[model samples]
Target: MTDRFRELVVNDSLVDIQYKTDPPTETVSPRVTYDRDDVPHVYCMKKTIPLSAFMERYARGEQRMWLAAYRPSNGRQTTITFAKHDRLTFGKRFIDAVAAERAHLFAPAQDSDGDASAPPPISSKKTAEVSSKAAKKISLEELELSLALQREIGRLGEDAAYRHEYVRLHALDCPNPAEHIVRISEDDVGAGYDMRSTFAGQTRYIEVKASTTRMDSFYISENERDTLAKVGQEAFIYLCRVDRDAPKNSAVVREIRDPMNPESGILLEAVAYKAKLSN
Candidate 1:
């Protein structure tokens, strides 16, 4: 990734840093400016870093990047690729991506029964059916904590809801399905909203709450509430009740719009307070 960034800096005069995949230009290397010509949060240009200034600095940091990669390999830690399995990894979405790769490498040659054909594009059933034949590959300690599993379930809910919105709008013949709905949670972590859709043609900002146990309860961050207040009635919360055993089948069961409105009958509780030390 750092190498790719170096290529961009060396080749391009000025590069735009909008998405996460873009190089981390704001890493105190360049004469970076929060060079925004438009307002923040509406998907306009936010920050532009002058990479020419940091070309030397960034090039020098290649040593640090190599050290990071080398140490993890030598210490028997997860690789940078597998480290992204940060979610519940309760053997779900995170595994789904690398499942085929893992199976191809470790899985034994299967029986001829006309099944030794080319594999499908890494689905759960195929990965499991093929890999299950091997010896016990993963142990209990290799798994994440219960809380992390719960978070993974929550992510499953988010994934389900994201797909639903895109499909629902497309099925309903929304003029532009691509423009009408977007999964903001993937790209914009601090946007306070998970999705952007249309409600009666008005812009709808949606915050999704997916729980394995209860749909009625989930923590709301300060940014989420602020978005609800600012967006007014167009703001909504999609409750996705996920089934741990079957995450892919889960779907958004409820949609609450404008919870900030007293008539909507939703409540917010303050969980913690910050304090400043006496001067």
Candidate 2:
């Protein structure tokens, strides 16, 4: 049976959506222009966006939805906006109705092109990123193992980076550099910092993140978050962006200081929590 698509109309605007089977949940910005018939029949909405972008926008904010589409005659694609609450309600109803009818498709697309003012739609131009918290199945052991491996890799990168920094300081002949440069990752005693180092008499705490891919995003533990808040300028995140296949000492180190500030635009997503039974 063919899968059905869902549709909703809002403020003279029509929004239509369906799920794609793509595994990578990254938003693919619309690249090519689609003809009027190719676009969805929603009020001036285009059908060029991937399912990932929809979910990404939903992740950032559930109150609204964004769509990529443009007028039929107009060539430029535009972002169409709508209230998600109302539209999603209609969508659930549509799905239930189709299911009641034992329809092969859950929410089939409608041929009704929206109001005349609505234009033919174009695909999305932005790629949206998926968050790890999104519902996906995995065994508890697998999850723990994956996390442990990631942490171990990160620690390796962090240790390498710290040693590199230490060597640089020693080369500079800084006063008792060995006394100042210390690895603190061994204990919670150092708080959220992974390594403590001094340069020109000032002490700085460093947190490290190691990634095989370019760091478009990274995880920040609650300890790191709180440490940033408390220490302010003294705290730094040393991003060890490594090309694993490359020879040794080839990782690019980028430092982000005071990342917890509101202007940083860093999103803190809670992936795990400790449960406490109520008394």
Candidate 3:
């Protein structure tokens, strides 16, 4: 072999040895980045899940999780809403509802009675909320709405549209979703259920209750109880438990089928009273 060729072979061998002994230097994880206006923006990879799915998977499908995102660059603010508590004022209630929920600070949406004009008690058969405990009358239906319970849900005012849409989407899924679900509350407050879903020759009388607290406590109006008795197996309730800080994987839709039945896992208290006034 020529001297120059031998020298080249020796150099190649040395380079191979160097590669076998050296260790790699850098490791990189997956990330998302955007460059705009000659500026670099980097973010960790995150899945943009739908709000409905977020609600369904959160807290066993009993409550909702809310997030308020403020994007100053886009001049957009995301606001959340629930009914207010009676003990707390408007500002305090707003802050508390959005704050980290503590056991003591936890309060479910109040019964219907807080509005100034008393839009209407949220306790009718078609109404999705309960009546104010404070409202008094000879019978359950005679309670006064002006007592102002200042609850955190079932306002049935501007928020009614939101609740209706939320319940409608959550009630059922079909190719023609809107067509199968009828909003009974909008047309008839005495129907004993908020929405009715008719699918595949089966019908469901659905009572939609939007709850802000984690408690399972609720008051059933006379009409609702009567309907539960009349439609034994067809009775269904969608108890939506809403929380501003519900976990990302919590449940949004919890269906209570045959709600009044013992096998349904719901506890119902019954009391038949005959009180006669004696002078």
Candidate 4:
């Protein structure tokens, strides 16, 4: 990362910086500013720091931080924040943060005018209101149909990713492509992975996920987390994003390699668990 700040001050805490890929206009670096807040001070570092460097710094007890990629021309900023929990499971948290940020960044463009091709965007208030009313108004049949459609979309995404991996492996001259790229999801539902393959003489266990619309967050099962813990660097993730209205082939795959470690900057939240009843 290029140091843009001239008068750099090293604080005990780290700041949340914005990584811009574009070239800087001013050759002279700006002075670093310090804030008095107890929480990690916010400083939008305008330099492009390598993800590895950031991970190293974060792991060395530097600070829990957030990174935002800024595209000035488009006025779009994609942010990745790693908290205390994230630092504990760095790999998964970091990948998730970047994936979410990229998802928003790569979201399909909206129509400038009032066009019928896409639905209008909804505000937070409007969305909440609609969600509350949807449960009361939606019939049981409609709910089931909606759920079924969602499942189908997810299935399509997984299939698209599997096909992508197969083609990629075949192109790489991996022997017995069909047998090599096995869909573990079909064979063992509790395996915590969707597929397995050999890449660069190492076995890769992959977990496939799909998102119909742009999303910064997705679900991960406990089994998947356990698999990640057990496999470590051998685990991989393939995120397939497809537009529900577009052709299935139009899906885009984002590959995450060896996404498990304390240095990965992933935050783990306790959302669900099993409980036993006492007599």
Candidate 5:
């Protein structure tokens, strides 16, 4: 039997084996002895029959075995389990799945040419050129429009903050109060445009003017004026008044109702109304 056991060990890695006959309800410690060379020699416990029986079956080729090792950090004795064929098969399938998932996760991104080689230098240069072209350019009309829009945006921002705080403090606010939306100039286009929140909503367009007082009129580009006329009654004009000295939080927003006529390119009488911040 010992010689048969030696043959069974040919392809197996040596491991410490602990065994129990009764089903384990909790962990248990068994006394073990090792040879002077540190090889496990004997296992003694309340149920040593299972370990002996397993060895016998393995030698007779009547059972298969798989070994696993574990080490605990709390200075507790390490443990190894000798699992049978069914458990070993389950463990192998689980390990294979985990390995496949890990390989997929760490897979490298493919290059444009479908190879792993680094991208060409000209590709980077082309990207830089495209970016430079998209950068905003300074034109006289764009510069004037941007300055005006900036002033309006600054004023609207303050008004919004004040209104938000005011509403928070006074809970009895109206169902629909007032709202402000500010956008700065970009793409070398500084014209103000109106956007309706919904298809059925009223149209509101704003042309901002920033000055010491409301005395100076600002320029409205051809495109800006055309957009306003197209929207009809839904269109409105927003006037922002700013003081250069009091730049921070220094402006006020006022709206002028339907201020343009598309068919006749005429400017309608400006009916200025103060912006309400509640909504």
Candidate 6:
């Protein structure tokens, strides 16, 4: 047996044992029982023989054999048994066999070469080149669209009716009206395709789905989905039903929590509202 197996036995790491015959035979094999009263488990190693005469005395119970033991708390441990008659079979190869079986327990030490002591440094020119490339990679069209959405949201503050209604609803909770900023636009802020907001600070990211007709669902973009996950509970969805053909003052607004949920059925009512920012 290798030192690894000995160490495992001493440390009480043995878990379980299993045995199977190579070719079906009727001969009864010897068994080793291991029962520890302190550990509350009983195990056995059966059908194993000594290393001596393992090849020639197969019929006489001298075949090379292995035994596996297990501990309930640890895992499994294997010990090879040699038959008494097989002593000459392993004359010099015993050490080699032990080493081969226990290879996983041993590892060579690292060399103390000076080459591994220090790492190479980066140049200033290389650092500047990387920064320049990163700056150039930003999409101008995306930036312009974001800026346009932001500006449109800013214009909603000038709408007197929207401002008064927002103030009447939110003023009781928020004493400072100046802190509340109303923003309305087809802006992809959190979890919906378009969002409108009265107070960006007190109110979380509000996704707005606007339609001229009554609809059952709305759409959310990939970026909006990611933003919703990032924002978590601080995200909301608002559906604005605006009759562009009717009186402008009669627009209807409805609020829904977690509109991105698949069960919400908002995706069915999605319409193409794509627009680019212009100078």
TM-score list, all predictions: 0.49, 0.45, 0.40, 0.47, 0.29, 0.30
Q: How many residue pairs clash (N, CA or C atoms closer than 3 angstroms) in each of the candidate models, in the order given?
A: 0, 18, 25, 7, 3, 20
Best candidate, TM-score-wise?
1
Candidate 5: lDDT of 43?
A: 38
| Candidate 2 lDDT over residue span 13-38, tens digit each | 33223222123322222123223444
lDDT of 5 by residue, 1-279 (tens): 112222112113222222322233222233333344433322322232233344433322231233332222233333333332111111222223333433433344587888754322222221222135344223232233234446444455444334432343345343443342333233324454632221124333444444445544556656776776676676655555554334454443655556675443344444345688997
What is the per-residue lDDT of model 6 for residues 48-116, given as tens digits with 9 covering 90 to 100? 332222221221222243433432333334333332222112211222333343232222334576242
In Å, residue 39's CA in model 3 sits off its true spot by 38
lDDT of 1 by residue, 88-156 (tens): 133333233233334544454556784654433332322222144552433222233334566667678
TM-score of 4: 0.47
Residue 24, candidate 3: Cα error in Å is 70
Ranked by lDDT from best down, the candidates are: 4, 1, 2, 3, 5, 6
lDDT of 4 by residue, 1-279 (tens): 322221112342122221223343211111133334322222334554444344334432233355553344554554443332312211223333433433443344556774523322433332222245332232232233345456656667777877787788889887767777888888798999988987778788988778766755567898898897788888887778865445456454577666666566556677667998996
Decreasing TM-score order of the candidates: 1, 4, 2, 3, 6, 5
Clashing pairs in 5: 177-279, 178-279, 203-234
* Candidate 3 wrong stretches, greater than 4 Å: 1-152, 155-173, 244-253, 270-279
Better of 1 and 2 by TM-score: 1
| Worst 10-residue lDDT window, candidate 5 | 84-93
Model 5 regions lying over 4 Å from their true place: 1-200, 262-279
Candidate that scores best on lDDT: 4
For residue 95, give model 6's deviation from the true position in Å. 94
